[model samples]
Target: MIRGLQLSLNKTQKLRLESALEQLESLSSKTNTNASVAVADTIPVNYEDGVLKGHGTSEMEGQVVATVCGVVERVNKLVYVRALRARYKPEVGDIIVGRVIEVAPKRWRLEINFSQDAVLMLSSMNLPDGIQRRRTATDELNMRTIFEENDVVCAEVRGFQHDGSLHLQARSQKYGKLDRGQLLRISPYLVKRRKQHFHHLDQYGVDLILGCNGFIWVGEHVEAKDDMVVDQTNKSEQQNANSGGSVGSDDQEQSHTSLEIRQNICRIANAVRVLSALGFMVTVEVITEIVDLSSSLNLDIHEMLGAEFYVVVAEREAERRRSSTKKR
Candidate 1:
């Protein structure tokens, strides 16, 4: 929260941003009634009631105490701490995006903004050929052919490994290499786990993946086909390339994303980035509204990140939340 702007700001704009921030804080405090606690803080609880301690809590010297810095939560006899500003808590079935950091013996290690690198076992995912069979040494050797270092990938939390480390799986065709787009990182708390995190803005021909790990993907929309069949033409092209022939210029051009789709990707990404910076919840509706705002005003793609646009967003968000409150 800033009274001034990262870019140049006028007095009026500064005051307006400040006012909007104050309003947002007020709304937040009103709805969030849970008491916040710090690490090792003594959590007041009725000892006679046989309190059932949960995560982020510990019993010491006959008193319920917090083990982590977070808000105190209670569910009947169960009490736990909901840590804030913490690492992404991986849960089974969570959709996440990550970058491949290492190609290991039988798996890929991915940096998913978690406590530890997540393991995507080679056996866990469906191969591009859509074959269902036992994995072999040849498949292990060709792991990089499917995914290499630094390739942005979409995956789901499979479960914790026996060693307590996070594990991932990409059995579905939707979970795989992400290209022709940008990746945005924001606070995980801003993005609540939801059923539909994969969004295709058909009007703009862009895909938006709100990864539960706080990694966002905004790129050109690719149709989700049931099978990831390798085209025979592509295979022939690969063979030609292996035989010392360069790829055709037309094929190179086809690989590049169109300027319009690229612009939309940048615009949508900027909208999410701005909302995250403003400490607002990043939801599909709010993001779409912001993108529509920029389009309606005919603002340049880069202008969406300017100080004036930030002021406008702050004001608009304040009003929208205000109206929703009134309706409720």
Candidate 2:
């Protein structure tokens, strides 16, 4: 009887439960069990308001006792799904963040926080013209330009390979190269352990670029004029700063200050490793606050490690998957 689950056993279910418990005990004893407990929805369970009513499977023999944690509902002698408390492992169709590490001729291998890098193929992409096509010589030459080493792109898991490798895709419009921003990396296990997926930051006009490899980007949109001004000012300021000289123009000074702030964003984030362990959704506000406190007060935030960056990466991945599914 886990804290959230109600124990309901029928004649068949009772026997199954007993066997499962025995197996669990044996497995636990043989090896220190690191198995994550989760509710088996496919297995027959009937419960109402924390009371067991009926069972799903009649065969009790060889069934393993599985520990489940969910809102207890009892009906007859069984327990059904009330709600999902936790889940383990990434599934097909799950939009995850990953990094491109190796580029093979037919496919690109991605480090998806799993045992192996998932493969993304040239055939997987639907070209800008909306036509599905194969890899071309031009595409091969442009492959590095499209997705290089250390470049983070949002993609979908097509399926698992025969050898347990993941098959991935980035065909749709939303899934592509991310640029002009800072990326924050966090752990995948921690991200899945948390329930809430969508962390919105409508307040700041900043956009979040999320990757399963834990790399995330937070940046604001810049118009053409703004881009030119920023580039010019940045170059001027960098030269002056390197020469140990101050700029005469206030605009240059302001640009210098902004660049310094942006550069420090990565430094401050990387310095605090513990922040990634906390699993806080790293929204723009959170970044801003950290910047303010650290730069102004010089207080070290060793406590706020493992924090997650908020992005529409999940939504974009989902949309891409849906489009792929429709096409298939």
Candidate 3:
């Protein structure tokens, strides 16, 4: 498991943490019988029946071998190892969050925690005006206006090009620039691919986007605006109103976030950080539960990162897993 947190614990706390981790290990062992192998380790397989090699597998001297350290999975003459800690593998239609790294002639290079920067072609995405016309040279020149460098963008994998580069598209309003949020990087394996990656917690006024590439975005929820809707009356009325009066400084005051909303964002973010440190599967359900648990205990958001909190979370997870096993 990935261990990135450094906690200063006393003797009892250390012992309890170790015990909780051991319990988690035992629970996983009870459920999964697949053997784990290291890189270059030969995977024992029947040779009489032709074996189909999958990801993380290579053939060496009539033997099947693993090129990554992970658990071996087999399915009807097909065998592969699912690597625990590897770069994100893009599949068509997978929604991913990425940062724009480069703006090329007709494409944008995005960093999505993959082996190579994924390509987002101008032709594949919709214009800011949400039109369905051909991309002209003007559009190509104005690409940066749509998505500049370092901007966080949400797009869907459009499949691979003939040159073996991954391609992405953002043709929908839901897929676009994300602002007013924090991005958290965790292990991609922890985020299991689900039907819905975009979640809006109406109760907390927060929008959560679980990127398949391990880039999680927690931000204020913004209602999706339809650019196609052209309200000329409202626009003319606003123009008339603005023409009559000078804009006051009060109107220009930045809308500051309320104290409560900021704290809620921090609490949710800390829950993610704690769960990542514990190497637990990070789902919306688990993250929400952790946030609720912390709130119920009246613990400050910063306290969630302390050694005691880590130990407590581990013990609680162990107990939860035990109860789950009993029910099964």
Candidate 4:
């Protein structure tokens, strides 16, 4: 019911959008009968069964009430409301994308769209040396070398401390500073937890990270380089020739990304933006479908955000949900 997008719809476009939304609402009504409630609204529950309240629900004046605007859910005796547009609630082992806000004494504080800033300690992450050695004063001093302020990073939740602050860790090669990418934010509820969040589109040559916290990253895929292999190669070269020295040459130019790859990244990113604007569930399958639809219609990347395309997407999503309901 939350429509955040503002489009200048004409008479025909407005009518089409209304019809599509009505169809979508009717389809959802048939599948789910869960009552939606606003803040401070009393939820009807049989107290004789001894209900256990969960998140977003609080007892007020001996009556069960909701503290957020969302749908009511009951799992046996436990009841809770799934908030639609709330801050990210991190769980252990969940992948997240955050920006480095500050470099502290022994930790890096990140603004991860949570209630509080999450902490990433120096000891919890892998160093550039890729060694498991203890973090000394030198390593602490060189914290900025790993992740500087304003750097976008990918990490995993490492549970919470006793002080109720979120902690993060990046121990694997797959987790580290992310560069050459665009980060897009959406409602955290739109992203559902899944087994795989890191997606590499082979055809487009792009990498997409669908963070559970609703921080989506779309960028060029960079291969993970192993520090240990580089170290071993350096040692082998030194043993072969004691006169081996590093060459310093500034003639090499940086390779620019191809135009096709850049276009693909923008197209995919715009697809995600359009989907989020429509308040639809953001899934890889749905996103891919939208991208394919745009391509099949010969719509430019910029045109995908136009009013006409928005109406078409809404109607397509309505049809998709209707078919899904029928299958159910």
lDDT of the candidates, in the order given: 0.88, 0.48, 0.87, 0.87
Winner of 3 and 4 under TM-score:
4
Q: Could you arrange the candidates by TM-score from highest to lowest? A: 4, 3, 1, 2
Better of 3 and 4 by lDDT: 4
The clash numbers for all candidates, in the given order, read 0, 42, 0, 0
Number of the candidate with higher lDDT, 1 or 2 = 1
Q: Write the per-residue lDDT of candidate 2 for residues 9-71, one digit (tens) a residue.
A: 456655554454454455345444323334442343332333332322222343322345433
Candidate 4 segments whose C-alpha is farther than 4 A from its true place: 225-255
Q: Identify the candidate with maximal TM-score.
A: 4
- Estimated TM-score for each candidate: 0.88, 0.46, 0.89, 0.90
What local lDDT does model 4 show for residue 44?
94
Displacement of the residue 237 alpha carbon in candidate 4, Å = 10
lDDT of 4 by residue, 131-180 (tens): 57899999899788678999999999999999999999999878888876
lDDT for 325 in candidate 3 is: 95
Candidate 4: residue 59 lDDT (0-100): 98
